[model samples]
Target: MRLQMHAVKFTADQSLLDFIQAKLDKLDTFHDRIISGEVFLRLEGADSNKVKEKIVEVRLMLPGKELFVKEHDKSFESATDRVMDVLKDKLVRFKQKRNDISSPAIAEAKTRVDEEDEVYEADEL
Candidate 1:
């Protein structure tokens, strides 16, 4: 997957960029349909307590779909981890939804077929 990273309000070092790229690469293991993606890393202004929040937004593009996740935490790593967890769940659900074979009509057809098979087996017994 091709990942385009955008650092907002601050310049990200090479290591940070590499870290993000590697993290995004892992998404291929979850869903092979991912074509490309974009990542936004922003360092929020320090609050009165001098606490800085790192915000990460990830967008993954599939064949005919796009998935997005945004999260903020004290560290970029933690935020990225949160984003990955959310996206993983979403991708799994998306795959399941796309591959669903248990529509109401299909379920009814399968039920009837099973009943017929069971009746035939009972007669033989």
Candidate 2:
């Protein structure tokens, strides 16, 4: 998966960037079809603001849909972790729902075919 990390208003250090990349890399294991991901880290204090105002936004791009989670914390790492956990759960559930929707008809057809095959075998005997 392609990951694009944008740190708004300030330059992010190499270690932090690497950490974000590693965290997001695990998301691909949940669903290999994920196209890309965008991480936006914005410091919300350009104007007069409080000290604990760091915002981290993660956007995940899939084949036909996009998932986004935004979180605020005292530190960017904490926010990133929280968002990643939420995204992981969401992705797992989405995959499960998609599989469930696609499997029922195939299962029913297979059962009918098996029954027909059993009848044909009995007739031949």
Candidate 3:
């Protein structure tokens, strides 16, 4: 998956970026059709009680739908891990639904429709 990363208020180092990339790359095993994704790493404003709380937002582009997850923690790694867990469950469910739609019954129904269309075209000719 192609991923674009954005750092909101601070610069992210190479090791941190590498960590995130490794985590996201593992997601390919769950769903190979993932087209691309975006990750936003932000430090929450100082106005809040917690100083510089880490926030991670991820958006994944799939075949026909998009998955997004936002998480906050004291560290970027933990937040990213939480986001990955959520995305994994969602991808599994999506794959199951896609499989269900392509079952033999649906395929047979689609075949019938195609045959009817052919017959109608012949009559018109």
C-alpha local distance difference test of each model: 0.87, 0.87, 0.91
Q: Give the winner by lDDT: 1 or 3.
A: 3
Q: Candidate 2's residue-wise lDDT over 1-125, tens digit each?
A: 79999989789999999998999999989888899999999887756655557899999998788999999888889988999899999899888877784688878988898988764566687
Higher TM-score: candidate 1 or 3?
Answer: 3
Q: Which candidate's lDDT is highest? A: 3
The residue pairs in collision within model 2 are none
RMSD of candidates 1 onward, in order: 5.9, 3.7, 4.5
The TM-score, computed over Cα atoms with residue i paired to residue i, of candidate 1 is 0.78
Better of 2 and 3 by TM-score: 3
Residue 51 CA displacement from its true place in model 3, Å: 2.2
Task: Give model 2 RMSD, 1 decimal.
Answer: 3.7
Query: Residue 66 error for model 1, in Å?
Result: 0.8
Local distance difference test, candidate 3: 0.91
Candidate 2: segments with Cα more than 4 A from true spot: 101-125
Candidate 3 stretches with Cα past 4 Å from truth are 47-52, 101-125
